[model samples]
Target: MTLPWETLTGEPRTVELYLTTPAGLALSRSMFNSAVWKPAIRATGIPDDRHNGMHVLRHTYASVLLDAGESIKALSAYLGHADPGFTLRTYTHLLPASEDRTRRAIDKALSEDQAGDDVPPSLDGLDTA
Candidate 1:
């Protein structure tokens, strides 16, 4: 779907097309390579020898989704991967520090239990000791 800011005359742009020049002409691969991508890389001051491509953007998107608590299966589907296992294998390192967060949560719960008055309702009948 065309975003409100993407149209000049307020008419929705076609969904099938992604890249277009300022004049509304479809941006060709050659135009993107020479006119857009190269200039962006040069502006960043990254060495020409370093890895640079549209795939880097895809990786960033996957990492952001994983860090935001999106399930691996859902990310896999969004990324068009055939298997969730592939997504897990590719993005395991990018996942958030859930182990640290879990530890902190448990510590808080135990401290609240010790305080007596703040014990969670779910742990009320359990032997917290």
Candidate 2:
């Protein structure tokens, strides 16, 4: 029931982690890239570059969280980064663009507010003035 991992020597081992071959060996990057990643991305007609590789999946995950207003600290933990600052440095560019935030802020500011609403502030507010 655990994620399978294989060492460079093709030794199967269990970690407190995340893939594996049908033989229960954790799928290696090379194996996955050749057997799965390459074919899938190629089918999608992407340029077949590293940017569209498996690494992009991590960025896509981070981007989703950031777009959803997840904090850097929270995203850092999810990304298993040692520090939130590293997460910021690595993924800050993926954050919602300032103009998008500005548009949302203005829309929100211009909207009528209902009294006695207990709505909590969204993290999107952090990205804007």
lDDT of each: 0.79, 0.79
Cα displacement (angstroms), candidate 1, residue 84, comes to: 1.5
Task: Report the C-alpha lDDT of model 1 over 1-129, residue by residue, as the tens digit.
Answer: 454443366756546566888887778877887788878888998754436765677799999998888999999999989899999999998998888989998887677668875554574533644
Q: Where does model 2 exceed 4 Å of error? A: 1-18, 97-129
Worst 10 residues of 1 by lDDT: 1-10
lDDT: worst 10-residue window of model 2? 110-119
lDDT tens readout by residue for model 2, 1-129: 433354356646656325778787777888999899999999989889988888888899999999998999999998888889999999989898779788887777555233225555555553355
RMSD in Å for model 1: 6.6
Top-lDDT structure, candidate number: 2
Error of 1 at 82 (Å): 2.5
Q: Judging by TM-score against the true structure, name the best candidate.
A: 1
What residue runs in model 1 are displaced by over 4 Å at the alpha carbon?
A: 1-18, 21-35, 117-120, 123-129
Local distance difference test, candidate 2: 0.79
Angstrom error at residue 99, model 2:
7.1
